[model samples]
Target: MGWSLSLLPPPEPELLDAVFLSAGRALHLANAFENKCQYVLRIANLASAFDEDPALTLDEAIAAAPSDKMLGQTLHLLVDRFQTPVPEEAVGLLNKARAARNFIAHEGASLGSSYIWVARADTLIRHAVALRAAVQALSLGDCIVSRWVSEIEEPNVPAPRSWDDDYPPMVDTWVFGHFNGLLEG
Candidate 1:
């Protein structure tokens, strides 16, 4: 909001460099928070596995992860678990945070000559803030029950309903890093 792309004068190099620096720091913090979340999930899942096989050690239980990218799948599992009280908005927010971090870190992304950096930094900073709070607030110790997972195996929907149907029809929301007709205000 502090800068506008359509303005005649492009932002100074100093400003761009500063935003870039902040972006890098935000990426690092967000990555660390994600690692912590993943570690917690690994232990939570190991607890579940141990419930079924008493002979299993934590190491043996953790070895059961079938894929290298466990955090993405584990977050989905935690969010979908009906017995846990994961916030409904948590899934989307976490997804946006991961996407923001990946785009900034992996796409050889750079601050554009205009206000694009403002938009990118805004997204990165907001998402990083959310991740930090989530990590601090997460309590995996209270959410390691396996009985609910086994008991609720069937889809008991009364009627076919899309998940998006629950959302409001429209709202003022900005998707970071995605620019169509909109520009940061």
Candidate 2:
């Protein structure tokens, strides 16, 4: 089972916007990570199915690569349908941004305080954007495959699959797990 944010009421516009933006970025990165996982998994599946066959050239191999939209859809399905909590680092950043957003939304203060909030908000946004770009870079299927080949060594290899492959691909569980991870449980 997973936790539900829907039970809560809507937050103030300014603060809510910031929180939503942070959430969006977190999701974006999480999706990227998942896509990379799938890319490698599918490639392995292909290789495993066609063992010792070097018939396809690099160009032919790329032609057989998954489409960009397919990759995006896979990530989207993993994130939206599965709802895995994002990594701790991403959630921590989101929490910081969300707290700032909450202060912005609930607290009615002067320009000085607002300016401070805005500064923090901008920083959070910048960090989120950078994270998103790095995630997007992983969309290059080659990079994803290369990472798996390089990182997971033989004899005790971690299977190259998305987190969802470990658990049932349910969105609520992912969200709950991610939130729990953020809270350090």
Model 2, residue pairs in steric clash: 82-170, 82-171, 83-171, 83-174, 83-175, 84-174, 85-174, 85-178
Best by lDDT: 1
Query: Model 1 misses residue 79 by how many Å?
Result: 2.3
Q: Judge candidate 2 against the unseen true structure and give its global Cα lDDT, from 0 to 1.
A: 0.40
Q: Lowest-scoring 10 consecutive residues by lDDT in candidate 2?
A: 108-117
Residue-level lDDT tens digits of model 2 in 1-185: 13333444433445435434445544543454544556655554445334535786656666665455444344343333223554555434333433333333333122232232233544434443443333333223223333454544442766555632322223223322333333222
Candidate 2: residue 90 Cα off by (Å)? 20
Q: Candidates' lDDT values, in order?
A: 0.43, 0.40
How many backbone overlaps does candidate 2 show?
8
Model 2's TM-score against the true structure = 0.29
- The per-candidate count of clashes, in order, stands at 0, 8
RMSD of each: 12.2, 15.3
- Give each model a TM-score: 0.47, 0.29
